[model samples]
Target: MPRTLVIGAGVAGLATAALLAREGHEVTVLEKGTRTGGRAGVLERNGFQFDTGPSWYLMPSVFEHFYNLLGTTTQEQLTLVDLDPAYRVYSEPEPGSAAPHPVDLPRGADRVRQLFEELEPGSGPALDRYIASAKRTTDIAERRFLYNPFKRLNNLAVPEVLAAGPELARLLLTSLERYVERRFSHPVLRQILGYPAVFLGTRPQDAPAMYHLMSALDLDDGVRYPLGGFWEVLASFRRLAEEAGAQIITGAEVTEIVTAPARRRRLGRGPRRVATGVRWRDEHGVVHAEQADHVVSAADLHHTETALLGEADRSYPESWWEKVTSGPGAVLVMLGVRGELPELAHHSLFFTRDWTANFESIFGAHPSVPTPASSYVCRASASEPGLAPEDHENLFVLVPVPADVSLGHGGAEGQGDPAVEQVAQAAIEQIGQWAGIDDFEDRIVLRETIGPADFAGDYNSWRGSVLGQAHTLRQSAMFRPQNTSAKVSGLYYAGGTVAPGIGVPMCLISAELVLKHMRRDYSAGPLRTEPQRTARQSTGSRADGAGD
Candidate 1:
């Protein structure tokens, strides 16, 4: 069996290792952090458990599909509670108004249609048409694009692509903002439709209309919460990996990827350099080098390229990285409040009247400190009793901020507590008035805030971006970084930073893409006839023209 080394125990890494191990490869996973999940980690403090990242569980079917691949179901391991009244959206009321306009989003399509009709007469049917279009986009993605790596032009010529190519092409040409504005007359409904673009790490005006598929996932399938928190999902990934005979070692920070001159010659030419092993340091400061037939980096792509591999060995240069647009950073405030927040739903969105300002502040050319008029609040304890003590609430507040903002005096190493506190206070005060939670700050028994700097220090995230690279039309699909490295043989990548793009579901798909390429390349021999660099150049041209 080929010995494979996977760096990082994030969802992508764990999934890759498990699948590879099942395929009879000797897999070993190395994680820099002490825990399994990278961004999707959990923070447990004083009887309160908080999911540090990825609070929204939007796509249940994606999770189900992954679990089913392992010959099991997500239901077999964890109880998933589907959230009813999917979420609540609170809009700052007009001048002279006493309360914010609160709109509770119901689960079923008929209920949502009714809610739309109530909000704006004649909008019910409009919403139905919009959702249908979104669903069609989703179908195109799921059938033609999501699974395939798009290595060659032929990969785009599938039967599903042939059937939905025209509609998909038209959707890709439009912007999400334009699509929503054309569909919804009500401001609240427009905000609701455009909100998912934030998770994609781009403003609605900039992101492609193809992203409306996110609304389909929200309205059609519904949002869900795992009983014990998102940590349970990570635990499940770890469990499956271990059961498949993949050994995961946490607190093992990989410093370098060791390469050796490959013995196998291609076309009677000189042997190429191939990744043979990795050097990592243990928790106790002991250094070790483990040899492997292949190396898969599921860590931060920028870190993997610049740090682990030498500068000379990088496929993407500094210039290419500079050109890449990173996703927005977030100010996450986790509060273990002393009492119940009865007015708030399991998921809530406090939207501002001016949605464009919120996007501009974060995704602008020279981003400033975000004075977000909108914020998201997740009251996990509202649905999951195990998350906090009885009569108490566990609140997770997220404010999208400029990824380029400096945390001030303390430097990037600091968790940006002062900055977080300042933002958190403002958000709490605003949300309190909006939700009628008087003395909300006073009820907090514990508070922890994670900022952009924290993301950089913790995960080595580029620009301290929480969602990795933004899925701009130029940066998406084949244009994104390839899973297979052009500079190094036996080196592969799988994560949000690479193709298939961001989100937890994307991470799972990324692993599968990496495995697909690995199998195709390494099936018959040690190397392919075509030079990896040459293939990359050819593919790069196609990628550039792909958007056009």
Candidate 2:
């Protein structure tokens, strides 16, 4: 069996370790942080608990599938509470006017249908049809598109599939903005279509129309919150990994990789560099080296290439970093409120007047926060009441910013932590003005902000991007980073930056893709038999005698 080392202890890294361990590989996961969750870490302050990242869980089937792979189920470990009114969307009743206030749309198909009808007469039927079409897209993408690595376009060349043409093609090219515009005339409906792209890390106008199908998964399959907090989900992964015999080494930072040089005595191929081991630092600040046959990096692609890989084996032109690293980043503000705001739901989105202009401000360096910028507010206490003290709440707020250095916002070269706080306060002010929360600031018991610099320093993420590369057409599917390294043999990638795109589900898919590649390359690995445990003869004393 090949010895495998997985870098980063996030969901991607942990998932990879779990799968590899199950495959009978000696797997060790190295994490730089104090714990394994990475951005999905936890924070506790003044009797309040907050899940630093990934507040809401959608697509329960993905979690179910993950659990099933381990011969277990999430139901056995944690309770899954489906969020109602899935989220509230605050959009100006008019495009640019501040006159009409926000509306809280409930979750589920019928509720959404009623919402559409209330907004504009006769729009309900159109919405129903839109949802039907979206469901088809969701089915096709989940069943066919996401499972495979999408290594080549020819993978779709099956004859029967070709006969079922124009479906995926049409969905891929359709823009979400256009779909919403055509479905309902109400401005509220347009705002709802735009919400999905925020998590997708692109504007609706630029996001592929096929992604609107995500609404079916979001509104239909439903949004859920784990019982304790999202961190509880991470804890579940940790338990699964340990139970599967995977070793997780937190606070162990790997610095460099060493590869074996080619030897003329070799039989098969003459002189090829093979990875032999890696050098990492333990908690005591002592450096140590260990040998391993394979290395899977769940870290950022840029960090893996420039930092870990070093001069070992060059992958591509250094210029490739320029393109891959320039994805979206954001300014985040997390707060612990004094008392619960009964008006808020588990998830809420406050949209900007001009979504395109807001992006342009960040991407094109328009210099200020968008006049009516968008903000995402997640109320963790609503679902899991114990996260905070009695009657208190935990708010995880985020405002997406440009990754551009020229924008001169909250980062290393700019105004620093104070700037992040100012911006967050401004966001809270706007949220208050729109949502009618008069005591917004006073409710803040404790608040902290993380900007571009924090992203780079804490997680080593490219330009502080919470999500990896932008999901532009040029960066989607096969065009995205390959799971297996093209230049460095025995090296693989699995995370938000890879195929099937971003989010928790996509990250899980990435881990599966890496395992598939490993299984193909290393034939000596465990056989895919019962998948629970391998049967082997034991070397204990014979049944008749015990050294008598």
Q: Whose lDDT is greatest here?
A: 1
Which pairs of residues collide in candidate 2?
Answer: 174-209
Candidate 1 lDDT over 1-548, as tens digits, reads: 99999999998999899878877899999998988899998878888898988878866666767766665565565666778878999887667887765899998888888999998999977888888988887776765567766656675676777788787877788999998998788998899999888888888998889999999877877777777777888888899999999999999999999987677877956326789999999999999999999999999899898888877678876767988888988888888888778789999999988878778877887676566558999999998877998878888888887775365211222244677567777788878888877888789887778888888888888888888888889878777887888878899999999978888888887887777787773221111122123223433221221110
Task: Give me the overall lDDT of model 2.
Answer: 0.72
What is the lDDT of every predicted structure here? 0.81, 0.72
Stretches of candidate 2 exceeding 4 Å from the true structure: 93-99, 151-154, 261-272, 365-368, 404-416, 521-548
TM-score of each: 0.91, 0.88
Candidate 1 residue 401 C-alpha distance from true site, Å: 0.6
- Model 1, total clashes: 0
lDDT per residue (tens digit) for residues 337-422 in model 2: 77768767788888766777887765563445565568888887887788888878888888887663332234322235665656
How does model 1 score by TM-score? 0.91
Residue pairs with backbone overlap in model 1: none
lDDT of 2 at 531: 34
Instruction: Give the best candidate by TM-score.
Output: 1
